[model samples]
Structures are given as C-alpha cells and as structure tokens.
Target: MTERSKEQEQGGQVRELLATRADEVSLPDGWADRVLRDGKRAVGRRRLAATTAAVAAVAAVGVLLSGLPGTGEQPPASRPEWATADSVPQALRKMPVGPDTDVPYGTRGEQGKGALRVMLGGRAIPIPKEYTGLRIWRAGDRGFVYLADGPGDVSVVVHVDADGTSTELERTAKGEHTTQLNVSEDGRFAAWTVHPYEGRSQVVKRADLTTGKVGSRSYDDIDSVHGFAGDDVLINWDARVQNIGSLDRDGTPWPSADRDGGVEDYSVASDTVLLSTSDGCMRAYSIAQPDNQRWKVCDMEDVHFSPDGQRFVALREGGYVVSDTSSGEVTGGLWSVPSVHPQDMAWEDDDTVLLELAEAKPARTKDGMIAPIAPQYGPSYLVRCHVEQERCELVDTGGPVKAFPSSSS
Candidate 1:
C-alpha cells in the first residue's frame, strides 16, 4: 500500500478506538474541579508566571477531551483571543530590518555580503553582531536563547531581549552538553536538559527568567526532556518511563507512566502529558490522574504542542496537520511542502506556525525507501502558516531560520 493508504488505515483504527470508548468514557464527575485545584496548587508551589492564565482557561472550558460524545452541547464558535491582526505580541511586532538573502545558514564564505537575518513581521531583521556564530533559539518574540561556546570549553545559555540586551541564564562546564532547551509557554522560565559524557545521569535545569534563579534535578538513564508542565519538568528516563517532577527538590518519585513500546517524544501541558509512542500512537495522560490515558492512533511521527497546549502540529505522510490536542480533530487542512523537519517548525502564535522548508531533494533507495535528508542540504526558506485560515506565506530570513519559544502570556 502507498504511504497515504497506511496513514488512512492508522487513522481509521484510531477512530475505531475512540468509537468503542465513546459510550464507556464519560466525563468523570468533578474532573474540572479537580484539575483546577491540582493545577493551582502546583502553580502556587512553583510560582510559575506563564501557566497561571492557561490553567484558568482550561478550567473555564470544562471538558478537556475534544470531540468526545459525552459533552452535552457544542459551544458557539468564537475567535481565539490571539487571532486578531493586532494580537501579534509586542515583543514580535517591531524588528530591525536588514538586507535579504537566500542563504541564511551558510558559512561565512558562503554569505557574500551583509549579516544574517531572521524573519519578523515578514521582514528580514539583521541578527545582532554579538549573536553571530551562536546557535539562536527564539524564545517567543520576547527574547532568544543563545547557546554560545565560552572559554575553557564551557557553554553558556544567554537570554537576549528583543531590544538587544542580554543576560546569562545558565552555563555548563566541559564534558556536559546541553541537549534541549525549551521556554515555557508563558515565557517566564527556560528549561533545558544536559547530558554528561562521564556520567549516566541526565540533569534537567530550569532558569527563572524573571528572577534569574536556577534549579535542577538529575535522573538516571534519561532519554530526553519534554519541556515543562507548569513548574515541573517532564522527563523520559530509561527509554521506557516518563516522569513529571519538580526541578528544585529531590524527593519521592513523581508520577510516572510506563510505556511498553517506548516513548519517541512527548509534549507537556499543565494538565496533560501527550506522548508520541514508538508504536505510532499518540496518548494523552492526565497529570492529576496518571492511570487515565486516552489514545489516538495515526501516522503522526513527530508531535509538537502549541505554546498554550490547546493545539498540536504533527507530521503525517510528508506534510503537516494541525489538530486540537484534546479532540484530535484537524483544525487546519493538510499542508504539503517539499520537506519539513520537526525541529524546524515552531508556533508563531496560537493560530500560526513558522516552518523551515528545506530544498534538498529526497533520496530514494533501490527498494524505493526514502532516506532522511541531512541538515547541510543547501537553500531553505521560512514559511508562516495560519492554521485556522489554512494559508501560508513565505518570509525572508537571510539564511535558515530557527524559531524561538513564544514569550506571550
């Protein structure tokens, strides 16, 4: 069967799973209340600035599961609060314009003239000279996470504001490599994971961008860090278990879910942990209740939750699909592009996504198996898609583009 057919088969199986459970899974009594109470307690303990509003919003929505049969009535359609043209947050509004070029990620020699630029407000904004040669991760429009190599083989994670000021959030000594850095949806904290070459333990660290206070916890045999769920960090340890725990305290084991198929990747929201399993299924587990899981089977390989966690973008059959995390309903139609890497996509806002389109030609083996493209492939462009409107526009980033985390609250 063709790849599209396989995706359809998987989608059909998922529908069947949901259909079988429709009558059996009713909204648990006081679920909303419990979620709110628990969420508030967690937020208060962590003093998280970013997730406070989100927890409240989820409470107001009541039903967490989308498209479930038990919801009494469908709510009237209303524009998302961040959908307006003016809704682009202030941090992302004004960027310093610069010369445009097609080679954004090229080497110094390959960049003929002018500095590299990033696409902001559809204009190419020159990257500050101080940020040149550093790996830049946009942390919302509010600021950036710059991974720069320092003296003595140390690496620093610097937080740079949109206006060009910066502060060092954290630093790593030699032998430790920072594998992932994720800014919380609210932009108050930056959480990252570090792997040590000499040790088996993986360290998860969080820097309070507001206070400059940093905290961390270490786990044995950690596979990856899946960002933050409110104040706590989500970690996949030993390749088979996922845990959510505080970064400041070391104590009793936090709540965990064991996956037999192994976890491929995961995204955490305040109320739920969405896992993309090795078996090719997406599972949502309630943070308040770990044993409860809702599964959706599909051909989605990589899963990325929007800043608010209300929606997610997944790769299906060489294209992109945006869906409601709760209901698994596609909000936008399929977007077909030449090549999209999960790491190369970021949510511009709740309703928009920024994608990096690679120009490399896909390689087909003798048996017709497509080989993965390396990052070095030449020429890429930045494309911004409005998920709700189902339209995309090309933006000029002097070179390749890397999206930072959203800073909007």
Candidate 2:
C-alpha cells in the first residue's frame, strides 16, 4: 500500500477504537445534569476546592489511548503536576528579564481615551499618544510593530523600542477596515493588507526595518497577509491562491488543495505554510515547492502552528488538541475551555499557549433547561495552558483583557 493510504487506514482504525472506548465507558444516568447542578452550587457557595476537584476529574478522563500501534510517536513520559484554578495564585506571575523568559503583551484600551500600553512583568509600559489605537504585531524585549490611526485619518505603521522611543513608518489611506499586522520572526520585516473604501482594491504592504524602505503591491482580490516566511511575504490573494514571493514581484501561486471549500486561515513557518481549510482539515505545503502537499490532520478546525513551528494546536469537537508537527502524533490530552476563540489563541512557549477564556452566563431554555450562554467577544480572561502537562492557570490581569505573546518570548 502507498504510504499515504497506509496512514489513512491506520488513522481510521484508531478513531474507531476511540469511538468504541467512549461508548464502553459507563456512567450514572443524568450524569451531565447532576454535574451541572453541583457545579453551579459550588460556584455559588464560592467553594473553589470542589470546583478544582470537578475539573481534575474531567481532565483525567480526557487522555485518549493515542499510544496505539501505527501512531507516529508518544509524548514525553514525565508530566508536570496538573494545576487547578484555585491552586494558581491570584496574582500576575512575574516573568524574569532574561534571554527567553520575558513575555511582552498588548491589551485593548479605550479608544481616544489615552496612550496605549504593553504589559510586561506585570507592569504597563505606555506608548506615545500618537500611536493610541495600537494593534501589536511582533513584540519583543527590544522592539515591536503596530498599526494606529495617524494624522489625517490615515493608518500608519509604528515601530516602538523598549527604551520608549517610537518611529512612525509608511502611511496608507484609512480604508473601510484594517487587517492584522504580521511581522517576521526576527522582528525585521512587517506586512499587512489595506482595503480601500472607494476602489475596493487591496494592497499588500511590506516594510524593512534595517533599511527603512517600504514597498507595496496592488492586487485585484487579495485577501490578507498570512506572514513572512523568510524575507518574502506570504499572501492569500482572491481567497483562491496562496502565493509566496517578494512584495515587489508577482510571486508564485499555489492553488488551494480544498478549492471547493476555500482556505479559512493560514500561518507561515520556516519551511512550510500551514493552511486550515474551511472543510475542517489542516494542510501543509512546502514554501520552496508549492505543489508538494501533505495532509496533517482531519476533523480539526481553527488550526495554528506554534511560534517555533515545532507543534500545532487545533480545535476538536469538545476541546483543543496539540500535536507534533513532523510526526502528527497527539502529544497531549484534550484541553477544554469556555467558548475559546482560536484566532485569539497564541503560543507563549513551545509547551504553553495563552488562551482567552470567555465568560459564560446561565440561560433558561423553553423546556425549562438551564444552558450556559457565551458571546464571541465578551468579557474574557487570559489563561495559560501547559499542554504536555495537562495543566492550566488563570493569568490574573486584574480584569477582562486581550493578550498575546511577544514574538521574542
């Protein structure tokens, strides 16, 4: 049998076994209802111990038998002790100032209220007032990139240094909306897409920090900037072709493997571009050879690769799963969170991810059943999950705020 076929057959068999095992595990009738009742009561009484116990029980059962034969590889044998919400201290954990320890992050502040702030070591460092409405791209211990409303209603790219010095780069006409800013891993080149209001034409812009040179290219139907592979900017044009080339050139185009469904989102790494298809599959393509295709995972949505490009996290049915990039082996048990936004999730390190936890409200259904209500963008808290160790801790940020890891961290 071909290698791909063999892999498919093995995956099918393992999934079947998991399904059967789930069915064979017996529990008391109305277990979900009982758990909900007790959980609600525990929360009302402010008994954190009970809640932690309940969470631990659920996490214990989340480990699937992924060590079956034909699976690529197994996870590390030593796992850290699982942490509970109560066990995690209710204080901002101070990240040491060092080569690979500090994590710089940006928070959403009231627009036109004051200067923007980036949180580091539990302290808020203020940026210049001109760069007020800032959306951070690449943050590091040294410098960062962001987009803000410049003078004359134009959108300007601002680069800030750790010493509080800032420089405003190229300015584009403020369009109907602005896409996220993407910077190379080295914090040198930055790219983003601008959609003009009148013409409806899309432009991909890139700036080189070393030379202070900015260039752009206009495309009829360019979607957004994925990221920077090396010096080249990866573009998703027309929602059909994912091109990898220079910002000054036409570039090479690779047709989406799932052309019928289209590409939902994509992330560029050192050697490959990970594309999440709308039909719920993660596909990887070589940057050097666009035509080379490899299927990574199936039935997984909202896929994102870790910053280091060694692992990836994807949303499964009930929760999220982390897998090795090369082997595609499930390295950690399922991680459950309340109404997680996959796009908001990012890697703090190889073994940990910073996730936004949505707030849930109880709602009564027509049948007199109580259900939890959650909104896409609601009051959210940041939590750090240790994937391999199956532990999570709430990051005390004082209140609900959006946070992302600095590229250097």
Candidate 3:
C-alpha cells in the first residue's frame, strides 16, 4: 500500500457550488452536448431566454438546446453590455459567489481554500462585492476587473495592455439571458448556462466568445446515465452495469462497454473506460472492443478511474489505494482517514484535489459555526477537505458542492 498522502486528479473539488446536481456537469458540443442536457440553458452565467428548471438533458433550455443543427449556423446570441468578454482573473471568475442577491447554502464551515483568484490576460481580476457580470483585462502595467449593466455599455475593456497590447475578450449572449459562464483554457471559447424560465434543467451550452458559435450537452439520465468516461464518452447502462453504451467523441451514441455489472463510477483514460462494479470489482474496456478483455477487480470504495485510465485510485475503508490498469496491480495503498463513501469526486489539476468532506457534514463542522438551524436535509453540509498533504480546507465558494461553480464565475 502506498502512503495515503498523495491526492489524485479524479478526486479534486470543483471551483464553485450550485444549488443542484444538475448544475454540476455539462456535455461536449454538437450531438454530444445536445443529447446530454436536451437543449436547455445552463445554470451558470450568460443570456437566458427563460428561467425554468427544465433539466431534461440538452432538450431543456428554451426548448431543446440539442437536436438542433450543429452547423455553427445561427448568428451568435446577442451579448449584453455587462456581459463583455474582457479578461478577469480566471480563478475568481470560477467562484461560486454570484448575483449578490441570494444567501449561500450547504453546510456552513470555516473556509480553508485561500482566496484563489484568476489572472485575466496577465493581471489579477478583483471580485466585485456584488458579482453582476464583469470583464477582466490586463494592460501594460495595470489590471482591471470591471462589471457593466451590459456589454457595449463600456467602450474599452478597462485598459489596453497600456502600449496597444489588449488581451481583452468580451463575453456576451444574443439569444437569451445567462446565469453562468465558462471560459476555456486557450481563451478561444466561452460556454454559458443561460436562464429565461424559472426552471432548472440538466442542460448546458458553450460558445466561442469571439465567434459566438454555441454548442451543448447534458446528463439527465440519472437512472440511465451512469457517469462520464474519459473525454468524450458518457457511460450509460445497457442491460448490466458494465454493459454500457459509449458515446463517441462527437457525442454521437457509439458502441458499448465489453464488461457488465452494477457499474458504480466509470473513468476514461486513453481508449478504455475503467469501470467499478457494485460488488467491489473493477474492469477496463476498449471503446473499440466494447467486449474483449474484461480484466481486474478490487475491493475498494469510491473508485475513480484516472484521466488517462492507465490506473485508478480508490478510497478504501482504511486508506487509499492505486491500481495499475494493464495488470490489475495494487501499485500502492495510500493513506486512510475514515469510512467515507464520497458522493462526488473531481481531479483538481493532477496531483492535488479539492474535497467537500460532504459525508462529514449532516455529520460535523470544524468550529461549529453552523448549527442545524432548519435541519431538514436542506443543504446543511459543511464543505471542508483534506487536500492530500496539508490540513482540511474549507470549500466556501457559496456554490454547489457538486457543481464546479459557474465555469464563467
């Protein structure tokens, strides 16, 4: 067993928190994004036509966000002035704080995550006392994080890189209104979960901030949809747990997983989907083979397939353990905390992770700042985490413990 100290990527915490699980995941573009959420606006920032809880896959927002044509055809949604694409600290932009109207939810605990802010272009974007959609920019010697009532509402994105170097990108939606926003790493794309109806849907859409070209996806298959496998494949039950249908990279429903059983959590690395069975078993499959070599099984809890699938990490009863996919070897058994069956897990970067300690709550809080006031299973969870090496950090972004916050913070 390896020392239970190293944190795995598949076990990281999200950037922000949402009110519902639907706000947590999103699909790819075109067919993939469409089938996932069923054409519904996302729960993050941007233009939303209606604010409805129609989380029925991409067929949610404004009707069906998916099933539409992925011709990149339509003119981009009309972005508002306040919704400019100027740069802001990518970190703060991903926080759970929003609108500045509602109060935070979930278990109240002492925050541990240091103020993780974003550096737009080059400068740090300051979070507004009220998050009313802002733009972030980094000029020569100055950095600005500005918010507007709407786009075009501001002429420039604060300041150009002083001497004409402007890495400012404004984000705006033309079709509906948005509640959440997400900017890609290269800064070439921006996806938003819009709002219009007073409803919630398991839907989401992404757009090239500059082109305004949009795409969508979803995960409303609660009973059917199992989890995400790798980059583009979404694992869903066929007959048995491992008898999974594999959605291609393009999100077009493809083949199926070779193995079968009560698939718990499935992770995709390379060409295989590492699946964990309910009976404490595990196996790997090749998207191409779907049913060839069904190998490996281990007794573990909270099994997570690594990003590359070369291996998997499971938080077993007493400690953590890592397994080699090829030979099903217990490379190492990490540390142990307590008996906690994590509800959700994400890889922060690769090594470290952000845990919610969710199971702990409905259980306990650090300083006990929060006492079950109206304890009724009404979001009374404390988001604290032990990031592998150090102490337990608090996830107090005011976002959904499950949601990665609004991709657009």
Q: Model 2: clashing residue pairs?
A: none
For model 1, residues 219-332, the per-residue Cα lDDT tens digits are: 667776656666666666765444455665543343444665777777776676777777878777776776677656557756667767798887776667777777777665
Error at 188, model 2, angstroms = 1.9
Q: Please write out the lDDT profile of model 2 over residues 1-409, one tens digit for every residue.
A: 8766765565445444434444565433443332233212211112334334445334333542333221111122211222123322222121100111135556545421344577655556676566546666654344667676765677777766666566776577545545557878667787777877665547777877666677877777777776776777776656655555676675565656445467777776677777776777777777777666765676666556777788877666655678777666666643444344433566766677766555334566799777566433445456566564344444545445544542321
lDDT of 3 by residue, 49-149 (tens): 22222223222222222333211112123222222222212222222211211111121122323332333332333332233344331111232212223
Alpha-carbon local distance difference test for all models:
0.53, 0.55, 0.35
For model 2, the run of ten residues with the poorest summed lDDT: 92-101
**C-alpha displacement of 181 in model 2, angstroms?**
2.4
Residue 217 in model 1: lDDT: 74
TM-score of each: 0.62, 0.64, 0.37
Show where candidate 1 strays beyond 4 Å: 1-135, 150-152, 240-244, 250-255, 339-343, 362-376, 398-409
Q: Which candidate wins on lDDT?
A: 2
Candidate 3 Cα RMSD after full superposition onto the native fold (Å): 22.2
